[model samples]
Target chain A: MRYTRLSRKKRSIFGSVQLWLGDDHLLVVRSMRFTEEYRRFHLRDIQAITATEQPQLIWMEVALFAISALAFLMMLEVEAIAARIFFGVVGAALASTAVYDLVRGQRCRCRLLTEVSSEVLDPITRVSDFDRLTTQLEPAIAAVQGVLTVDAASMPVFAQPAPGTPPLRQEDRVETPAGKYIPLLLYFAILANAIAYAAGLLGRFNEGFGAAASFWFTEVILCVLLAFQPRRFGLKGPMLGFFYVTAALIAIDGIVTIALIVDLMQRIAEAGRSGTKTPTIWNIEWMMTAGKIAIAGRSLLGVVGLLALWLGRDRVVPASEEVPPSQPQP
Target chain B: MTGDLRCDSCQGGIPPELWNQQQGALCPYCGKRSWTRVFPAIQHTVAGQSPEAIGSESESSCFFHPRSRAIVACDSCGRFICGLCDLDTGSTGGHICPTCFTSPKAPGSGTLLDKRRVLYDSILLGLNLGGFFFFFWPSLITAPLSIVLAIWYWRKPRSIVPRYTTFRFVLVIVLGLLQTAIWIALFWSVANSPGRGSRGPAL
Candidate 1:
């Protein structure tokens, strides 16, 4: 059978997802750097398609891109010509992404449901894509399975429970405490480190270093608390692993910072004895390669952490809400 | 049927009354706008059935489940399977036993259980490119490996999506040859350099 491209490829940092229309089925291919996974739904088997508006998420992306672009623009004030050019290019790139996201218009979360499974059409992030997919799929599916009429409602596909069955109630559902705030807090702490590191690069070493040190201390406590009760925070798999990794990195950061501080103290003592001018702590030359590496690592982790959290946020649920056991989630 | 449709944001059931409305309905739980299009298949429901017991001594029983009466024979192995053990390959029109369905090597299993395919072209390309740029020294080993992989899987299917061109395989071969040639020339130049023996003796 022949397959034709149905939708434009939607890309993220890690991988991409695309849809293809086959002669008899619709294929969703998720392509990573090394491999591709395929999920096919027969045209006759599709039960329904739902497109939900996601204005808040689209606005979040716009704000994130705009704010990040502005933050990078701050580097233009740095004295180094190389630094200014590098940050300028980065800022321009971020600004362009923001514009692209805005021009794409509103986004939606579209899912295709069958009797056996429900699959998200990730490539149909834009509302336009959803409309196009539905337009294309509707006729093809209708040709195979025919159309549903208003009179069909009397059929009642779902069978009622036997007499005196207890209906699922709000109190019957499992009440999970809101674990959403912990991850948000972790994100804040990591972001603060990233900002502090940038400030240090711009001649505010003492303040930046102090701020980073304080945040790491706070992060250590937060990570430990979250690690102890991961289910409470609605974290599993990679999100849970992130907290463990953060704890390890915090320890490594502490060791590296303390070593740098001790070396700085020794240099100050030597300068006092020799009666020479004391070197400024803000001097990049004075900082060892290891110190520079540690700060940069922290900054990179912070950015990656933010993206990962945002992409996987759907799995997390608020504590105030209870999810019923009887109803299966799509 | 209402329970079948759910709000994406809140995971709450969407009311059946709003199933095919022109204007999207506000989700009762989260108050988000959601549009739904239901098809005729939504009304197609499968009724559950329990396997029957063996009525007589002469009656055929399920191969794996001996106590239960045989309902259908496996399309692959011809073994009788009860209702509980029969795995229907929907649309493919076959009733496969659990053992036959799970084993990819089983005859006719590919039609029922093909899920993933490895792209040899992509792997060959990554090995050649990543080795050459990131770790120059490792290319000595990887270059030859990429050459072998490219030639070995030249006719093998790369992607199920039908990538018509063999461009990646060709590129991998060319890159591998170039990288291997560079390493060989470097080794030759170093070994045959002037004063190479004399310098070593003086040391």
Candidate 2:
């Protein structure tokens, strides 16, 4: 059957709607008003759609997780000093990525709306088919859009709901503004940890301890809360919640490594002051042991979650095939 | 589908090849309909450095007319500032463009140092040449006033005119310190030396 691609500029009493007909010719109407549009589409109209890949965002996220994983691995190595250096590098990388992602994500989404499409459409129609579409198509669409666009008065389309409509419900899968801050906070924590670790390496032992604690309490704590809340509080679906939580756990592991390095530095400083062969004030072995345990626990959990997501990717609902009547039914 | 494709809104003809390029096609005229049988070539535009490259240049237009270009450069930031951006400095030839000059340079700027050095030298000259007169009552007040003026101006911000130089900073610190040292030496010498007048009981 032949499918037709249609795009209509819709303006209601409330706001504008940008519609996209996918390759499958499935109509995906993104209303500026709600997380989910009230209008439904007949699946037969869609042929297929090219997906947007958010590689910049995803790669950035993955890179951070990888660095955290590398830091954890370093802790397991025989050379304690080398492990500390690795941990510091990892902390710095994580923090940098977090900050970049947070700022970039906002800017990207903003730009995407203004520069690319005011609204996006996927060909899949049924809710059960979303998994296939998100995995196969959403990333492609994100890639095409590149960074989010911004104008003087407003951000990109998808960043917020349409004007004159009630706010998105908590149950909808859309990201809340508060959720955007999670990555930024994570990045800050990483930055703090990096500074502290550097100080330890430089032999400024006192400053290092202060830096580590500050990062742990501020960045790590916030990340942990962001990670746990979406699932613990049932704020969002398991897919998105998993991404946030896993990313947070990985970031926390990076922070813990920095703390352990601080402990080691303190011990070394004490040894120098006492002119002793072995330090009595602090135990390097115990600190290393604690770090290993944290890394192992977080990484294991993250790996499991990632695998589960990959496996369950096929079950998501696809966009529906039925097109709604042009006029509202009386 | 085999015939010439036309945009529904504008009735403009679409290239036949575009219909076969991808799964969906975009209309060239109204840009509304997507052709399901064909995709179009993705056109990319390279951005170049244009008049918009400098944002501030656009904002600071001519004061008299909003549309005119700002012809003058602000001594600060080297930005093109309009007539409205100009500010007057109190000194002779002290007209400072507002965009460049704000408050006086910090103590570290060379210009502030030069002014300070000049003030310091004037104080030393007054104190040394007029110290003998100060032995009498009237000259002492002028001497004290000169000293107070030197100190007061020394702490103030530098002038907008005659932009500050680095050498002036070093010169001021050195000259101020040397003058103070000399004044102390003179005071000590006169105070501690054997008294010409015997106010005390005869030894």
Candidate 3:
């Protein structure tokens, strides 16, 4: 059967998502490193398609700019020319990415709902692209399912229950919003890392590495929690992406921290044997490539995590408000 | 499904006023702008129904459920089935009974439920390149293994997405052979070295 590409493929580090219009179905294909997974929704079965503007992209832009500013500050403090160049390059790259994202327009999350499944169309990130998709798919879908002309304002089909439908139980009505404690966990971990970094730069070896160890421990726990609880916690969209990135950054940081610790131990042992003063951690860190990278990664993660926490903050409604208690406050 | 379209960010129900609005509306809970397009299928309620009882002996009954009237015949097994048992596979694949569709040995069951495709070409490429990038010693082990796998899966069904060439497989095979040859030559040279060859007498 012939297929027409519906949207341009959106790629990430791990995989890419694309949409294709098939003979009787719309196919969403997710291509990973070595395999391709498919989900197909028949034209007649689609109930609704939604596109919501995501403010996380704006937060991401702000975070990147903040990181660039932090890098500029670091560049001013560093004495080595190599360190200055590294900071300058990192700052430029992040600033350019932020500017590019700003110019590309707002991002959106598009989801397709059928009777059985609700699937995200990740490739259609831009609002304009979603509009195009709606225009193209509507006619084809209407041809199959026919146009529905209910007084949507008065008779929202989903708002009222069908005949013989059972009411939801109060016990089953409880909801655990996504990222309930995850952002806070990330916040504390980032704070610990920042303290550790500052302490390390000040030559307080024990205090610095101890804080680093705590950050590593927190990250390891987070990795395990994220693996099992992503869906259970109702995590979705950009917040989900943020947690994944945090997990990855921590893994890299773990390796770099271990290397730095090993190097520090050797330097301390050498100082003891030679009857000389112990070398400061900063003195050794500035001299190593892995140390520099660890420091930079820490700063980037800090900025991003702080912004994500701010954006994803939950609001508590007053008791006088008539809104349904089941509604998520995010 | 008896609710409005949910906010993409927070999963709260969107009011009907937000549906198909050109400017979009801010969600009451999350304040995110949601653009929703409702379709006829949303109103297509699926109420559960018990199978019709056989009123006359002339009417055929379901093969599995004898008391219930048969609505359609299973495409694969040709057995008369009730509406509940008939699983439609859209326009291409006809309706099938649950037994035939889920049966591993059924003739046409494989393609009907195929949700994923393992791209052996990409796997072979990764194996070949991973070994080379990490170290040459690993190539000694992975090279022969990849060569065997490449040949074994060479004729296996590839991705349904379609590709024009087998260039990746060819490249993998060539690289595997080259790595194997290099390892063999290195081992041969090491064994035949003058110092190593004369080591027995010196010991």
Candidate 4:
């Protein structure tokens, strides 16, 4: 209950944040230029302190393994010494990257009995620093709790507040990280739409406007969805307003494209029946079998991408992550 | 439930009868000058639900625990889940399995389900600053996006945390308008240059 400040120290955060260690509570205060925020947790509430190492070599390991596999597979064609040595070098590098990944890149987290967990301190990249930091914090927390102390008659410790002391921060709403890759999938769909459009342009849409309209229509849809992502995540209000506007735009484009496709197909049918098709029409990629194939492939990718977003809808966690797992029921 | 309160200093439980004593009466347990108060009564109610156990081959089993009974199916993936596997979807009003809830692509995408988000205000401010510090013609995209984002999300919810403020929204608009004005002036000057359009085509 004591609001008197004992000691204050600057901690690692986005801005000038301070850690105020008081008689019985640890208060963390942070603020941007205009806004300020703080959270207070009772000393006795913390349950566990964990130091986790997260290495940054998972991507490199995967890339190197693929290269190693490719090199090893090539050994069947060329039995030369260079091929064998190349495979050995890649294979070694991949193994070493995997080892480094396992051995390095760790972060620390503090678990509290109040159903919340957070990385109180900055991430520790080194093993020695990790150990030292945890040692410093564990004892400090125990000292404040009045239960565990280094000395039996330690300097008449801080007053032991009651067990039911209320914490300032009861809960934090964190967004899940479920459909994070949706943007990438939507981008791929956009790329597919671009290729389809290019094919339609090559097909000379003056004769068959349907092909060009459909491809461009699909492209517009991808753009709308991409723009809608931010609002879908957490950006609400006017961001949502633009989202609906974008949806309307895509819908209008869809309807127009459908009409164009129908008209273009009708023209093509009429041209074939009358044997009046332009000679250049045959050379157009959008009109050819290959163009249709590309269009089909891109459509499939777009569908799959949308499916991924739909499935991973509930997986977004807030940007400021640290919520720990809830305790299991007895 | 006993109508008693625990001492703030020593955590000694004091019964309701103790409230009739002096304002700063000495507690017999800790000998601390404690102040006893009568708090509003609380009615505690405990309810229970029996989770169905995984039975024969015909019955569904919990996804997390194979032996536990499948009481509720995950609303997201429709996978049969046990009571232990059921986690509250916060404000989403449903129960989901740990796997689907934690996954970044399982479709539980909402404000409650999101782990982190690209703060629109931050992006808007950054764009405004970028445009202001270097408001060249090439910052057309950044300037427009800054203005749009600032105006659009002006009244939107900022962060899930209640401590933040959206004062940056004004800064973004101010900076963005300044940058846009500079670009407009530059374009106007270029357009009115005596030689630009005049020299384009003598043909």
Q: Whose TM-score is greatest here? A: 3
DockQ of 4: 0.01
Against the true structure, whose lDDT is highest? 1
Q: Per-residue alpha-carbon lDDT of model 2 for A10-64, expressed as tens digits? A: 4566544443323322333433321223222222211123222121354555556
DockQ of 1: 0.19
Off by over 4 Å in 1: A8-14, A58-88, A152-330, B1-3, B48-99, B155-157, B197-203
Q: What interface RMSD does every candidate have?
A: 6.9, 26.1, 6.9, 19.9
Better of 1 and 2 by TM-score: 1
User: Sorted on TM-score, highest at the top, how do the candidates line up?
Assistant: 3, 1, 4, 2
> DockQ of every model listed?
0.19, 0.01, 0.23, 0.01
TM, chain A, every candidate: 0.42, 0.32, 0.41, 0.28
RMSD of 3: 14.3
Compare the candidates by DockQ and give the number of the best one: 3
Candidate numbers sorted by lDDT from highest down: 1, 3, 4, 2
- Worst window of 10 by summed lDDT in candidate 1 chain A: A321-330
Cα lDDT tens digits, model 3, B1-203, are 73357777776666565567765655555555678888888876655446788889999998888988999888777889887777776763577878987774566654534578788999988998899779667898889988999999899867665554288898889999999999989999998988874646644
Indicate the residue-level lDDT of B17 in model 3: 55
TM-score of chain B of 2: 0.27
**1 against 4, candidate with superior TM-score:** 1
Compose the digit string of candidate 2's lDDT tens values, residues B74-193.
Answer: 443444545455443222112345433434452222231121223243334445335535563333344445455545556544322222333444444444455556567778899888
